[model samples]
Target: MSVSLNGVGLTHANGQVALSGIDLQVSSGERVAIIGPSGAGKTSLLRLLASNLRPTAGQVSLLEQQPWQLSARQRQHLRARIGLIHQAPPLPPRQRVVTAVLAGKLGQWSLVKSLLNLLHPVDMSGAAAALARLDLADKLFERCDQLSGGQLQRVGIARVLYQAPELILADEPVSAMDPVLAGHTLSVLNEEASRRGMTLLASLHAVDLALTHFPRVIGVREGRIVFDQPPATISPAQLDALYANEQLQVLPAPESTTQASVQIPRC
Candidate 1:
């Protein structure tokens, strides 16, 4: 299993419950999409799987190992085998794109090599190749600040592709792009995962995109799994129920004014 969550629950330090009873499992090379309304614990769940947060209750197993049970050093080693694509990839504004992409392998490289690469990108071709896959090869030498939002998001994905981890987790990976670009980016990501035989789990807000791209979709609401099934099995009624918003208000149309007709005196 690439990921397994058994009765998982998380409570923040400020005493806020983010998730509870999240029982999910993904086998190797499986592509799964997690969809839910905003603030519905989607990011929290991804964080848990990434080993960024420890579950207050229950277990989280990633890459066949229980992350919380491992030692700090062991967990760090484990992290090298996993790639996480953040929505706003925390790349340094002034940093060159090549350096950012090469940083993906910092965990696996020697300290000396890492330091040298930082001073001068030692693998420019490798970085360019990865970016090329995402159609950003021309931006290889550009400063991260020069790129647009969607371009930056693609750069983040390229970094992860360079990392080539066993498992990939993305949180709103294509949220910044146009519909066509978003679809293309997702196809690239899915293809990469398939080629590498790596497991992929992404949290998306686009229900139609999720249903179209992923074979299996997991719907989350209010910190719980509402449904987990193939796209074909997910009903529109279920989606309506899942996204029902009680706080939504419908505004009435503006009242029309009836103008009085004036009689023409010269007729």
Candidate 2:
């Protein structure tokens, strides 16, 4: 198995409970999509699974090892085997895209090699190939500040592809993309995960995209999991209940034909 969470929960130092009583298990090569309304603890759950945030309750076992129980150095080594894709990648404004992509291997590279690569990106071809998969090959030499939000997101994904970790955790990865581009980009991501047999878990606001791309879907609300089932078995009512806060904005409609236009939240 790739990961197991036994009654996992997280509470901030300020006494804010981000998640509680969550239980999830995923095996190697499984691709699961997490769907939820904003502030529903999706980000917290992914972060917790990635070992970026420790749980306040329950146990988390990832890549067959308990992260909290491991020594700091051991934990650092464990992190090298995982790839995290942020919704908004924090690339330095002055950094080149090639440098940013090559930085993905810094955890595995020797210190001297890392320093040399920083000076003049050693794996330009490798970085270019990763970018090409996302239709950003031409931007290899571009500066981070010169790209738009969607382009930056692709760059972030390119970095992960270059990293080729055992597990992939993405949080709202395609939020900035146009509908067509979003669909295409997700296809690219899913294809890569399948090809490499990487365990993939992503949290997405686009429910249709979640259903179309992932075989398994988990819905979360109020810091708790509402449902975890195969996409074909998930009913419209369950999805409705998961996003049932009348006070909040309703989720958007399916943006493109690539996404199945069925059973979505509405005002």
Candidate 3:
């Protein structure tokens, strides 16, 4: 599967332009990262690609289906095929972790089964296994409200794993975690997505993490794409220049040169 955007632009309800004349394509199994300052329209771009927003002009296509062309049912079907991870994991606080993870399978399951599982959570084994992949097996029965922010993020990932979508859209999936946990979480995501040959598109504030984790990187500024390159090809100076105008904080230099400690803007 693939996603293509041609001359696509988005303007807010109050006439604030968020994206302008964007043209890009994401192919199956490609891992792409979007990086930029806050309010640079990073989220807007993802929303456009995910078909959550209609372009004010031009076209947005996923696979062979046009975003505006598809029927409501078809759009839902297409969306169900893509997995999304938000910057802040938003699971129901009162729900069990296992039940939250099981919700990922709702798109494929029958309505009766979904309702039945919601009440009793019959397929705890699958949810438990998915959690195990993220080293959260013990938290299966824990309430979502009790899990740490990092733990909640892992649960979100576990849901995506269980859903097994063809495309994974992760918006700073580990921004709230410490560096060690962030690397581990991203590694798990990359490994799982690679195994399934799924396309992974992520929007991240961590320049270093984007460079370290993603093969291809796209930069946005004022709703315009400024840079799109491979990690190795992009220099630190270039990154610094990219966010020079924004008020930001650089991470403390890394302990070792062997590990990437690319500074990210605090925004």
Tens-digit lDDT string for candidate 2 (1-267): 999999988999999999999989999999999998889999999999889999999999999999999999999999999999999998999999999999999999999999999889899999999999999999999999999999999999999999999999999999999879998999999999999999999999888889878888999998999899877777656776887763333343344322333555431
Q: Which ranges of candidate 3 are over 4 A from the true structure? A: 248-263
Answer with 2 or 3, whichever has the higher lDDT: 2
| lDDT of each residue in 50-151, candidate 1, tens digit only | 899999999889999998889999999999999999999999999999999999999999999999998899899999999999999999999999999999
Alpha carbon lDDT of each predicted model: 0.87, 0.90, 0.85
Task: Give the range of the ten consecutive residues with the poorest summed lDDT in model 2.
Answer: 252-261
Q: What is the Cα-based TM-score of model 1? A: 0.91
Cα deviation in Å at residue 254, candidate 2?
A: 8.1
**True-structure RMSD for candidate 1:** 10.8
User: Once model 2 is optimally superposed onto the true structure by TM-score, how far is the C-alpha of residue 199 displaced, in angstroms?
Assistant: 0.6
Which residue pairs collide in model 2, if any?
none
lDDT winner: 2
RMSD of 3: 2.4
